[model samples]
Target chain A: MPAAPVIAIVGATGAVGVELLGSLARRNFPLSQLRLLASKRSAGREMRFRGGTLIVEELTENSFDGVDIALFSAGATISRRFAPIAAAAGARVVDNSSAFRMDPAVPLVVPEVNADTMQGDEAIIANPNCVAAIAGVALAPLHRAFPIRRLQMATYQAASGAGAEAMQELRDGTAAELRGEAFEPKVMPHPYAFNIFSHNADIDPQTGYNGEESKVIAELRRIFDLPQLPVGVTCIRVPILRAHGMAISIEFDQVVDPQVARDLLSDAPGLRLVDDWAGNHFPMPSEATGQEDVLVGRIRTDLGDPSGRTLTLFVVGDQLLKGAAQNAVQIAESLLPAH
Target chain B: MPAAPVIAIVGATGAVGVELLGSLARRNFPLSQLRLLASKRSAGREMRFRGGTLIVEELTENSFDGVDIALFSAGATISRRFAPIAAAAGARVVDNSSAFRMDPAVPLVVPEVNADTMQGDEAIIANPNCVAAIAGVALAPLHRAFPIRRLQMATYQAASGAGAEAMQELRDGTAAELRGEAFEPKVMPHPYAFNIFSHNADIDPQTGYNGEESKVIAELRRIFDLPQLPVGVTCIRVPILRAHGMAISIEFDQVVDPQVARDLLSDAPGLRLVDDWAGNHFPMPSEATGQEDVLVGRIRTDLGDPSGRTLTLFVVGDQLLKGAAQNAVQIAESLLPAH
Candidate 1:
């Protein structure tokens, strides 16, 4: 790899795409050139980068010709068809879609949790699902200390998980509802005005779990190297804009002190402890919206477990930052020769 | 007991108090007279009921003298001060606050789940916390069949639980947020616009569980007649208006098929099965806000328990209806001699 690689961001007009630019600029990533690539409709758009304007080029077979590092944030179908081609064009591909997350050859990575899984020569590095990436940062510390026996999670997801269009829909729909006007949802399957619903991902006929829940389960297992880890999750989309929150219950093999778990999490990478009991303050989507750290708090022994073998926690993270763009950027950073 | 009893609403100007009037009129309970009572500030306020307007009277020691039944929903402080006085005035009391819920003499009741716990001789009947009443109706049927070993719940609570003021705060805060204006949160401790936070109830220092959570655990145990039933819960306040949703994971003594659980919930009263797998439609707060029955769906085998001994469900109930006023009214109805 060259001293300063040419970095390319695919799907550069979407929510995570915009955040990718912000993360790269804020981190002061060493890059010789930056290329913004998107669909034809957004091809001529100009995006600000490093105090300069970069035009978004239409993604084509020739888009990755001289690119050294390509970050793909488009949908799975786009990644499935183009990631290999980008890799064949000599770019190290980091895909932020579910297309290759579960593939045996792909190293599903949450850099803080499983950076060692990445081999520099791999054709593609798949980013874990947003929930998996956020929750893994908080759970990894405790699981490493005591080994999680079982995991159960309930998510309060935001509209940005659906994309920039869904975020605008939430804003528009909420405004109309406040004015006592009816607004039809065109992006989200359900109304997004002060409402909550099951995730819009297609539900599995046999398992009864939605596609989003399944991805979190599979990706967390791969990220933790626990192939058969039992995980149960419910994903619900709330009316918030860009942050996701989750309530997680983890059962350990033996009794573990909550304070010990807290101590471990307080020292974990990419995590911040926000547990304040007297103040009645913990992780909230409002506080985590633009922050890179996953806010972890509300740590307590699980009252549901009489054996003192379980702990419950609340975690919040920016869906577009640490959950996607920042994580993908971190993986690319780890692949640099200096690391 | 009279066939047509005289009824009184102690907190008639508040959210649940107004709903109490609606429930009485909608259910067409046999009432000869209705008394609307509130604090000094709200006294003399006119409220509509059964196509006629009733003047709100200031609650006093003499308020319940000729009243056959009293429904109290002002707050825990008001209930703690006046519930016994009202009961002494020969009015059957159905208290909606947390004052007398755990008292051995007061029968905490969810009519469909455990009305048998209410003996006609009791002076005060305790209406459970919103989450307990809503969850109990759905969990009762399953626990009766499979005998629940443990339970874990994460709640998406609405603003109405805090009172009429908090609901308005949500609306005003959201409107201000949409317009890019700053709004101070006077009713809620935290920002209420398009955000989620830990339950605002005071947290217990020892357990790190908030008062709301503790009430749910203790009340659910009492309602189920399982004094030591292990229950783990996290109560969160969401941005919705009037309905509360919970994701519950239940562990049974043995492996319980999801289909069997579905059959039991389907036949259960006070519940409507809303699990439509193909439609990706489940219980949503918008659909549950004004409904009488609790919407139950997303029933599946919990993968968190590889033993197949656990099942998960998503339940949504109107916070003011099934959770508070309607439940209190149902208790008063059961107390009538017509039974």
Candidate 2:
């Protein structure tokens, strides 16, 4: 890239965008210049970076003129329209939308799982879905030891996955619920306070799987390089703010002992074992809110199968951190030469 | 039975006890008298019934002297202590606790599933756990169409299952969360506001299954009369007030069509089909709360199995109504001749 890359954060006013700024600062990503870009509505907004104020400018084709790296977290339509322009302008684009993830030409990178697959010479790199990123990081080590044959997942997702407005909606809805007042849903389709439902994403008419669940399955397969791996996912949105939790069951080609899996997960990168059976503490969303490492626990043999080839566990990870912003920052860090 | 049996309600001040009173009144059970029984602390409390006030009496050995039917929801300790005394005093006891559920001597009854197994003359009848009861009502219809060979379940349980104090703890916890204050949990082990956790039950170290999960598995096996059927369950407590939801995957010996399952569930007793695919609405805890029937939807073939023998669905039910009090009252009603 440049001697020290000039970076631009598209959609800098959104949830993941705000987190991207914090992640770059917290991780101390080496950069000579930082640019904040957003829609016209947030054009005049000021955000602080490295103890200095930076004014957000309206994103346009000319916004990537001198930028060496652009991190895109805007909606898919915006990314699809602007990512190519940024790439053509000689800036490397790391897109956080689902638009380019399934493209054979694009490399979906988690950094922890498949950093080598990302070609530095490529103009754009795609980030996997939040659920996929979290699950891929936790499942990679185990899959390396014993290839996973099948996976069944049930997700308890938080409001941040939808966007910052959805998070505010959850807060306002819950406050109204506490006040015994009716709060009509604006961001989400249903009442989100003190209630849980299947993911609000559109369902596949033939399969009945929602968009999030389908994305998770496809992204996990692509990230793991297991094209034929069978995955069944049911995604539900719970009334939480930031972190996402999943209950997963995996069947391996060979019989795997839970202790062996636990030992492997304990030493795995981007993961921490929080399984304290006696304490009745496992991976909960509240404890995983601001943590970088995904918390994993409740490692046990699946009682449904007697063949010892199945294992079940629960995992939680910060959706804004490793699920999006931190992962994107890590990919950027992987591109730079070792200091 | 005597003309209009004299009914006694044990633990008349608890969460399920309150629902039991409403259910009895709503169903208009033919009763000559209603006796409210609770601990000495609540003995003097007066509750309204049939537009008249009844004084709560202390639950002593002599509380069942003239009672024809006794409904016990106090707890296992209280049920174990006094249910036998009531039965020996010539009253049929319907216990809503884990105390006698697995006892071969006591018939575990869910009127919708296995009411025929219950003999009216039996001195004691045990109700299934709330999770088991809800799952039973939803799964019985499907299992009958095609025998289920394997089952996997993940539950989203509510606060009322833990009792009235725990429900209040949730309410207060939410209010404290809204105020940005620290809430030290008094009824639950963890902070339950906008958080989810593994069921707060003692884990079986050898199996890694908690008590509630184990009870659900055992109760399902007993109710279905499939002694060797395998069930894998992970029970979680969510931050909802009343209803419980479950995501279930079933593997059958033969292929099952989703349309068949939907039609059967719609016609089945104690279940309401809420699968609105076009509207993107399925069973939700908020809709299931205070509803008599368990809501079932999101039925589709399991993508993990190519054999076409597996299906997955979602369900929600009011824990108090069909899960606990209503089912117990139905058992009591089964004892009386037609009005």
Candidate 3:
């Protein structure tokens, strides 16, 4: 790789794709040239980037010919078809899709948690499910200090995880709801105005876990390197636009003090402590939207665990940025040679 | 007491009070007379009840005259001041506030769970917290069958739990948000439009549990007749109008089959089953709003517990009805001679 890499952002017209552009520009990433690629429908669309307009081009097999780093934010089908081609063309791929996440040969990474796991020579690095990525940032520090034995999570996911259209669905449906007008949902299977439902992902009849919940469970285990780590999560979509929030209970191998865990999280990279007992303040999605750092708070010993080995925390992160686009960009940054 | 009791509703203009009137009407409650009482501000306001408009009378020391049963839905301050007065005035009081909930002498009842705890002669009966009441209904049958060993909950509470004004605040703020206008929240501590926040209840510095969480913990233990039940709860307010939803993990004394739990819940009173894995349908706040039964679903073995003794459920209930008004009316019904 050269001192400045030629970067390409796949699905540039989508939600995370737009954020990917902002992330690269905001970080002032060392990119020799930038290419924006999307579907045929979105091709030729102009998007503002770094005080200039970049035209979206239709993605083709030859799109990554001279690109050194390719960020994939399109869905899994597109990633499955094109990521390997990009990789074979000598471009390192950071895929923000489930296409290669669970593959044993690929490293599913939350850069803050497992950047070193990236061998640098791998064809593609996988970004985890949004819940897994957000939770991993907050859980990794404590899990490292005291090995985690069990995990429980209840998520308040946002519409952005479903993609850009769902975010617009939330806004439009909410406006219609306020006007006492009927809205037939087009993107979401259920109502999206001032309401919440279990994640729209199809449920696995055998396990009773939705597709999103299953992905979070498997991806978290991979990211933590705890192959057999038990995880239970309920994924629900609230009416918010972008950020996701969750209540997580982490059980360690032995009794752990909440204050000790709080101290550890305070200094952890990619985390900002928002826990304030006196102010009745903790991680909130309204504050987490558009922010790079995951907000971690409500840190306390789990009252559900009699042995006192568990701690409960509330975490919030931008589903588009930290959970997808920003993390994918960070993985590309790890390929740089300055270090 | 007379064959047809004289029922008095305290704070009749409030959210739960309005629902209390509807609950009584829908059940065709036997009553000789109905008295509607409220604060001086709401006094003289006309509210439709049963087919006629009842004029709200200012609640005073003498408001309970000739009243056989009094249902209180005002805040704790009013309950603390007026509940005993009504009791002393020869009325059996069912209070929907926290004033007397933790009192050893007061029976904190979810009628479906612990109706027998209230002796007909008791001066006052306390209703469990909204979350506790809704959870108690779904859990009582399961706990009776398997005996719960541990409990953990993460709540998606509604604006109605705070009261009528908060609900209006949510609608107003959300409308302003849709219009791209500014709205300073008047009732909630945080922005209420398309946002979620930790329950605005004051935090208990020592335990890091907010007031709502503490109430659920204490009240659930009281209702379940388990003094030492380890309970952990996180209460959050989503932007929904009335119904509250929660994801709960219940650890039982032994390995229990999800099918067995499903059978028990299907037959349980005050609950409606909504678990449909294939159709991707589960309990949702939109469907639970104004519904009589607490919708329970998403029942499965908790993968986080390797012991196989834990099950997770998603529960949703109307915050104003079962959470407060309906439970209070049910307690009053248990006082009737036939019951």
Best by DockQ, which number?
Answer: 1
Estimate, for each residue in B1-339, the C-alpha lDDT of model 1 and write its tens digit: 799999999899999999999999999989999999999999989999999999999999889998889999999899998988988889889999999999998999999989998778898999999999999999999988989889999999999999999999999999999999999999999999999999998999889999999999999999999999999999999999999999999999999989999999999999999999999999999899888999999999999989999999999999999999999999998998968
- Candidate 2 local lDDT, A59-117, one digit each (tens): 98899999999999998999999999999999999999998999988999998788889
State the displacement of the C-alpha of residue A1, model 2, in Å, after optimal TM-score superposition.
1.6
Best by lDDT: 1
**lDDT order of candidates, top first:** 1, 3, 2
**Which DockQ-derived CAPRI band holds candidate 1?**
high
TM-score of 1: 0.99
Score each candidate by Cα lDDT: 0.94, 0.92, 0.93
What's the TM-score of each model vs. the native? 0.99, 0.99, 0.99
Which segments of model 2 are wrong by more than 4 Å?
Answer: none
Superior by TM-score: candidate 1 or candidate 2? 1
Pairs in clash, predicted candidate 1: none
Worst 10 residues of 1 chain B by lDDT: B330-339
Q: What lDDT score goes with residue A211 in model 2?
A: 93
lDDT of 3 by residue, A1-339 (tens): 888999999999999999999999999899888999999999999999889898999999999999999999999999999999999999999999999999999999998999888887898999899999999999999988899999999999999999999999999999899889999999999999989999999998888999999999999999999999999999999999999999999999999888999999999999999998988888888899999999999999889998999899999999999999999988888888874
